[model samples]
Target: MTIERAVPAFAGFMILLSVALTHWVSPYFVWLTVFVGANLFQFAFTKFCPAALVFKVTELKSAGQS
Candidate 1:
């Protein structure tokens, strides 16, 4: 998958994994999930995701047009 797609996919997977951890492992993990979710939400709203930036950099380095 392209870096553009991978960033959000990884973020989503991490959020889901965090949720699962919170449910099956420890409640503290819920905070971690919340932290990730908040960042994603902020990115969605502000259009300034760090993940997206990283993806863009990787894409540029790889000579991939994003």
Candidate 2:
């Protein structure tokens, strides 16, 4: 998927994973959901996402070469 799609997809996946972890693993996993939400919140104003950056650096290198 494109960066536009992948970022949100990744964020959603993290949120779900965090919730599952919180349920079966530990409450500390809720912090992960909080972190992802906060990053999305800041990205709204800053337009800078670390996940997107990582995706760019790693994903582009591998996928774009195809």
**How does candidate 1 fare on TM-score?**
0.69
Top lDDT prediction, candidate number: 2
* TM-scores of the candidates in the order shown: 0.69, 0.86
Residue lDDT tens for model 1, 1-66: 676577678888989999899899999998988888898889778877777677777653323753
Instruction: State the TM-score for model 2.
Output: 0.86
Cα RMSDs of all predictions? Answer: 3.1, 3.4
Candidate 2, residue 2: how far the Cα is off, in Å: 0.7
Clashes of each: 0, 0
How many backbone overlaps does candidate 2 show?
Answer: 0
- The segments of candidate 2 whose C-alpha lies over 4 angstroms from its true place after superposition are 61-66
Best by TM-score, which number?
2
